[model samples]
Target chain A: MDLVDFARGPALKAAFIIFILGIVWRIVNVLLLRHKRILSEPRRSVPVALLAGLKGTGSRSWPHPEFIKRTVTGEALGYSYHIGLFIVILLFAPHIIFFGSFIGARWPALPNSVVTIFAVITITLFVAVLARRLGHPVLRHLSNFDDFFSWFVVALLLVTGLMATAHVGAPYHTILGLHILSFDLLLIWYPFGKLMHAFYIFPTRAVDGYVMTRKGAPS
Target chain B: MNTSPVDFQANLAPEEAKLGESARVAGAMRGFAREIGALSALRLDACVHCGMCADACHFYIVTEDPQYTPVLKVEPFKQVFKREAGAFAPVFRWFGLKAKITGAELARWQHLLYDSCNLCGRCSLMCPMGIDIAELIEQARRGMFEAGLAPKELYEKAAHQRRTGQPEPSDEPYRDKLLAIGRRFNVEIPLDKPRAEVLLTVPRTDIEHYPAAVAALVRVMAHLKADCTFRSDGLVAENYGYYAGGRDWQREISRRLIDQAVACQAKVLIVPECGHAYSALRWEAAELMGKSLPFKVLHITEYLAEALEAGRLRLRTAQVGATAFHDPCQLVRKGGITAAPRQLLRAMGIEPRETVRHIGYNICCGGGGGVFDIERAATLRHRVVEEKFHEIDQTGAQTFLTTCSDCRRTFDDGKKRFNWELTPGSLLELVAEHLQGG
Candidate 1:
């Protein structure tokens, strides 16, 4: 089989299976672990606690006013790249068609040119993110192989996807096959690496918020 | 005013000396394994190493030291989780991706966890992934305590408190001290009164150095005409066990107060102006007991705020010049007692000039979590105090007040060290001074 056909057939199927099962296994492992019962009285009612949990998930997304001056650059960089990734992945016409095929439904998509602009900006932000990780003393000290590798995996997909779109590297089929292969690597690594934060972030935030709110201090 | 500096450090315990190196490491690992509940597991899995938590840590902000980063301080604990209990543990072991936590690493983190962190919860608020770095650091302290690697001063105090129901400088009986203070101040400090409406507690700091605060508490109870009493068995509001990460002792200390409240049939258990004490009884006591507490737990400020709001307690306006209120970390961020103190201040016709960061986000006084008792941490603690001094000074207030005795003590230390004019005053004492009909 040709590179594109193999990439779209067996490789893509294996990646999808691994991705779904790995995510489930990790999540269940965490959920089934020992959890201490909270016997303390909650300051707020159940409904209020739940509402606070939801609010916390959203509130923590932005820095508090006191922290903005020191944290705005990192926060901005993080938000900007995440928004760019969403546009490139979900709003681009070709990418939407690819994703929509699984659900048997199609939605309107952003024009290819608009998607390209977002993709380029995202790639730049990714570079800036790496630089910040390397340059900031605290970030540099805290980072590990998992962190750098996670960045590489996602950045590889973006770079190869851009190359395939602009026809800058090899033929279209070859570049597209490389992009799909990179995605397979990401799928395999997602559960084991820090990339699992995508699934864990909101839940963690909600749980923390609920806990603090129960103490009458919602962060 | 007890202007002389008192050494807060306590002697090391004999058991700590008996722990061998390898056994200490095993103990630490066991402690870390025990704390890996579902919530902690999720928080451990959620860290993205973004480093934004550093900005929220006063230790890192002042020192600019990468080692002081909140997340890095818990690295060894997180490493223990990844190797022993994580979802990918088997895979990580096969590939040797994560290493077993070693004694050397735990020794290095000893300073990071005990000396540097205040467990203030600020870093928890700053983490984008909601990792609760401060909580993890507390868990890390659990490991350190288990390994007998906790700071000697803090560990000794915890051990002493667990044994005697009070920490160091217990030269005389606690009841004797309370009676002396009552006699000295001419305030009625009723002891062990059955069926009292309120059971009040005091911190050793107040009893030893600031006895006026104890008198103020009684006078306020008298002014409200509330049936309140102090029990010798539960007189302490300080929890060295909570500060030192000895869970069993923490539970024991909390149980003393809980049992006293129950025995007296008190409807309310009022924690004095002690931050960690309020947290221990108000939030953690029930959790440790495996059931809800029988009586309501209120910080002294909260009780005062309620009385004023209900119009049962009236205060005559006093000409206390421009004042600033320092919110204690455990009280404001962890206990949610922010508004009560402010409300009490406003009721006395004094509007507090707020620091740059006040209320729930206020900076720690650099002495919470028992860091004040460690001699090695004094320099670092002083640097943080200097930063706080700047923040409070910027408000340009003549009088400074706080609700936590530890904060008051730390500020008092800072006053002596920096030769600053303002001595930290207690809100409870301020209230007692202005009681209209007293």
Candidate 2:
């Protein structure tokens, strides 16, 4: 088989299987671990506490007012790139067709030009994120191979997908094969690396919120 | 009140010195494994290393040092989780992606977990992933404690508290101290009263250093005609066990107060101006007991605020101008007693000039999490305190007030050390000074 055929067939199937199983394994490993019982009386009702947990997921998405001045650039860059990724991955036409094939569903997509604009902006933001991580003392100290590798995996997908769409560096099929292959790598790594934060972040925030809210202090 | 500083280092036990490095590493690993419950596991898994949490740490903010980053402090503990409990642990081990934690690392992290972190929950609030970095640091402390790597001062204090139900430097019995303060102030500090409505407790700091606060509490209770009593068996509100990460000792220390409150058949248990004490009881005590506390737990400020709101206690307006209130980290951020203290201040007819980051996001007093007693941490603690002093000064307030005795002591120490103009005052004492019809 040619590059695109190999990437689209066996490689895609294997990566998809690993992605799903890896996610389930990670989640179940965490879920089945020992959980501390909350024996303390909650200040709010169960419904209110649950609501606060849901609220926490959204509330922590932005910086608190006190931290905004110092954190606005990081917050803005993070939010901007995430929004860009969502638009490019979910709202783009070809991407929709690719994702739709798996879920057996289809949805309207943004124009290719609009998707390209978002992709460009996202790539720029990703670069800025890397620069910040390397330049900032705390970020530089906290970063590990997992952090930098995770950035490279995601950024590779973005850059290759853009190249495939623009027909810039190589032939169309070759660029498309590289894009699909980059995606497969991402799928394989998603559940093992920091990218799993996509699944873990909201729930962690919600749990913390639920706990603090029960103490009458919702984070 | 004894104004003299007690050397906590003098109380250290010699047993820990016997453990070899290998044994220490094994102990810390075991402790880390034990602490990794589903909630903490989830939190550990959720960190994206966005580094926003560094801005929220008082230590990192003050020192601008990457090593002081709150999340980095727990790296060794998190490393333990990833290697032993994570889903990809086998693969990670095979590839050497995550290495085994060592005794030397735990020793280095001892300062990060105990000296720098206040367990203030500020970084927890700031984390984009909502990782609860403070909670992880607390877990890290547990691991450090198991390794016998906890600062000698904190460990000794916890051991003393676990044994005697009070921390060190008490020359007399706690009951005598209470009785003496009551007699000196001409207020009745009802001790071990049967079937009281409220069970009151004091930190050793108040009984030994700030006795006026104890007197003030009694006067206020009398003015309100509330049936509150201090039980000698559970007189202490401080929990060095909680500070030092000795869970068993923490539970034992908390159990004394819980049992006392239950025995008195009190409806309310009021924690004094001790932030960690309040946190130990109000948040973690029930969990530690494996059951809910029988009575309601309220900070002294919360109880006072409730009384003021209900018209049971009245206070005359004071002329203390441009007063700035320091929100203790545990009481405000962790306990959610933010509004109560401000409400009491308002009840006393003073509008508090808030610090730059007041309420839930307030900075720690730098000496919290028992760092004040850790002699080696003195210089770093002072640096953190300098930042707090600058924040309070910027508000241009004449009187500085706080709700935690530890915060009070920190500020008092800072005042003496730096010759700062403002001496920290307690909200409870201020309330007593303004009692309208006592």
Candidate 3:
């Protein structure tokens, strides 16, 4: 935690306020704005689709599968990019330490060797997805401004996670400061962009289940 | 007796009539935002933009319009939800592909739903993401409808539904046509029949476009001595209103049918050939009426299954040669009447080869959600059936059998558009046409 000096008392106080208020506003916005359909059953079979999608059918799926059939090459690359991103976001060393110190009591972090490998994989996977969105004619037509922002956020997340690693770059707090700043930006930016899909997925999947069962679409 | 499709604008004061028609729109930003947010939260990370859904879309393949890409259909709203995902999300809002809402932007929803999509379940067949674009279309329609924008055709249909107790029925000299048909069939075709064993509801198309499907049903009932009758009140149960995002209109249509059935004190109610009508009556009408139906009901195919299973109604003509089943979008996607129709086909001793995409995975006839407007019909209802056309061809079946009148009409159009030679017919007609009558 070498950058403890950079986390000036005023900065910690400000970041702390942003984190709390940002989260509250976000929760309120999502909760209030969401078209609520009180749950009757779990929605789309994301778990079932993900399991089936893991090996041969990754890229062609939405988050859960069904609707259209996709090519093997695309599904594989898609799963690789997303799974890598998930690990990077959820298990990044700094994120782990932050959560561990607060929740786990002991910081069980990914070894530095493993961390480097994940960063490389994540970057490659992300670039591959971005290329498809930009290069493919159909996807290109479908993509808009927020799609690029999604790419930027994903790229920033991986880079910041890598740069904020222990003794990896310009000491901890300076890099961590950028990470924190991006995060604050992320919290504020989330409600109005494609990133909001994160909160919407569960219910969307639920609706899928309801409709599929209602319509009797093949499992 | 007027079962033909009527042009609603015909009755309108030239200007209002000329307005085509649309559904209700309530400009509720909070609800719309949440709708977008829910989709974004679920799929933003989920879609890798693999382009797998491209082939799943009939319109995309038919026109090769890049905008017809399935992901593009709802992606705009997804972007909006992402911005609202967080404080930082606002920063990403500028990255959204779908534009911010406007009166002009909202106007496009009609094209998207009625023109662009046909409520088919084909994409669901291929979607690894399982993103239901059909349902999303409904949401978009609702969003726009609430905002005071609706397609002229749908608005007119809804108005007619409120007025006539049916969305597409004509007020022409159809009563004469009904009487002639009754005389020709030599059956008691009761118009406003009092009490009967069953209350039979037919799509408005039966009274005009494809009278044979209805005629075939009437003949079968006559031979079986089944005391069934037709009613001009709530004569049509096709709920393109529900498809067009008009729940109140849909409820009104349902109420009329239920009241008609109750008025006749029918021991049972039978829905013929129309898929959405079957769903609207069996599933939605009950809910809309705030009670279960007074009498039991069955789809014609389901009713046929019962008769065939009972060994009471024998098939007169055995269906020979290969056949394929095309499940209607609403019947398969909304109504849950898959195997019963197939079973009816099999009982007639027809050799049935299932389509590559069958049952719930069947593509919509592209006529659902009220895309019946002729102006934008070209763009909205283009022959997006290469997959289905191919699937049917693969079955080596010249006849495409389904349980929906809407499918019958759309498939006929699709056949002409795609140069498909296969003929679409009803499941019950097949049984009646080939039924082994003793």
Candidate 4:
């Protein structure tokens, strides 16, 4: 990896620990959110509904699209931005060098020109979404404490990542330490905030799709 | 060629989804939201939105608008339920501080109920989901009624039905009219015959709006000479209040209808293809009336079919030109009398042609839910029934035969609007036509 050595002593250790712990915590929270009492309609053409990608043959498929479009792109930017950030994190030259120092692993890096362009596009999309959360009435209505809190963490990651790349902070060790510290905090907070939807989305959609199938109705 | 304009509103505020703010009936929308959410997942898990119902609808036949497609009508409820009770509630409740019962929204809702739907419940049959869009519309009507946003026509009709037990604008000579029609038709239509073998009841709409169906029914009975009669004391037989969403109103009107049957000691009762009337009477008749009906209840088609099947009566099939049958939303969909009317027509050697979505998933006549709002959107009602016009044209049928009075009026509109030389008549009318010279 032909980049800076940004991760110092404690910074490297905390980052790995948070990443491992946060992902596990999120899984637990989402699993507990299921509604148990309202049983499915009894064997009402289950085979037919399963084939239709529906749970059964009774409801109107109205709002699922709106929910996905808005939430996945709106409050879910916590996960979306973080995901983009994650790739950037792995590709960061100094972070790669640090990971190599610790685990003796190295992957190919994006040349400097492409890294800057990718960074610009990723940051621009993040900013546009952030402005939307603040600007759009519907999105504003959907924002709560957790929504903004999660986004704030993403903002911190972006700033630190930028500062490390620009070499605007302290020495190699100090800038690396700030970047790692912010990344670790985000990892730990990811599961508890709006970003938790990322882990829940695939499972929840699968549940929706499968239930639709079981009911033999269209979702 | 495109008689059915697909540009319609029922979901996602296609010009009518705005929430109202009314402090008086303030709790209606929220309460509505809660109740809707209460039933959302249950309802969602219940329907498999297959296009099977397409063949059962009148709107699809007339307009060919996919928006009139039955399952799509319930979209707004799904969206509201998802935001409130599904997974998106925390941020969406009371988002900007608006209340229920706004004059504007009430007006829009009236359009949705009266103009777009008739709550005929025909779609319930084709529903792999059996989701019951008619019931949901009834629920929404109830919500609007609670908000005091009910259409003036709905309220007025309900009030009349509540007091007089019919959908007449007034009940001044309702009993006299029944007697007059039966006598004028030259049928031995007995009046107040006690312990009659059957209590064949037609909607007050049949009497007020289209008296020919009642006259036709009486003539058919006279020809059969079946021991049955209409109870003058049970003057009005329609139950409009049920679809307005008040269980009490539903019961109040239902009790009167049943009371007449019991009082006359009729052995059996037949409901005409008035959708909500049938729903309020036959489906919930046992529960709402609290006492079991002493007689078997059937749609007019059912009893007539039985009469024809037993060889007690016969028709010569006088209707000419490729005529098609419009299944009343309730008769085929809710009451499950799909085959009775068609079978009756076929036995008469009519060889009835069908619209695209005939029988179980019939489109509404745009007259159920007391949508008999003549003052507002009268043309829209006729416009809504245009879906049936093209279907009738497709069948090359010059006659439109249906069992419900509302459907009869709608078919008439379909004829006038399309400038087609079509005649609109009821099944009993067809029976009367067959037995005209008998």
The candidate that achieves the highest lDDT relative to the unseen native structure: 2
**What CAPRI grade goes to candidate 2?**
medium
lDDT of 1 by residue, B342-436 (tens): 88888889999999988888788898889888888889999999999999999999999998889899888988899988889999999999998
Which stretch of 10 consecutive residues in model 2 chain A shows the poorest summed lDDT? Answer: A40-49
Q: After aligning candidate 1 to the native by TM-score, how far in Å is the CA of B221 from where it should be?
A: 1.2
Residue B102: error of model 2 in Å? 1.5
Candidate 3: global Cα-lDDT? Answer: 0.61
What lDDT tens digits, residue by residue, belong to model 4 across residues A106-215? 98877656665656666876788778767753344334465577777877777767766777877755665676767767876664445654444333334444443442
Candidate 2 per-residue C-alpha lDDT over A15-37 given as tens digits, one digit per residue, 9 for 90 to 100: 99999999999999999999899
Whichever of 3 and 4 has more TM-score, that candidate is 3
Worst 10 residues of 2 chain B by lDDT: B1-10
Q: In terms of lDDT, which candidate is stronger, 2 or 4?
A: 2
Clash count list over all predictions = 0, 1, 93, 43
Please write out the lDDT profile of model 2 over residues B93-138, one tens digit for every residue.
8998777777765676777788788899999888888888999999
Quote the positional error of residue B401 for candidate 3 in Å. 1.7
Model 3 / residue B38 / CA error / Å: 9.1
True contacts kept of each: 0.79, 0.83, 0.32, 0.00
Ranking by TM-score: 1, 2, 3, 4
Each model's TM-score?
0.96, 0.96, 0.78, 0.60
Q: Write the per-residue lDDT of candidate 4 for residues B1-438, one digit (tens) a residue.
A: 011123333222221233345542454555355345323344432332333343344454444444455544544444444344543344345573112234443444445554556776555433433445555666666655555545555665776678766655554678777777767766566777777777777777777777778877777777777788777656566766665555567778777767877877776777765655665676666755556667777777778888778877677756476668877665555555666777777877778887765555445666555655544556656666665566567888777777777667666665676775777777777777787346
Stretches of candidate 4 above 4 Å error?
A: A1-219, B1-23, B26-41, B44-107, B121-130, B169-171, B287-294, B317-321, B435-438
In lDDT terms, how accurate is model 4? 0.58
Instruction: Give me the candidate number with maximum TM-score.
Output: 1
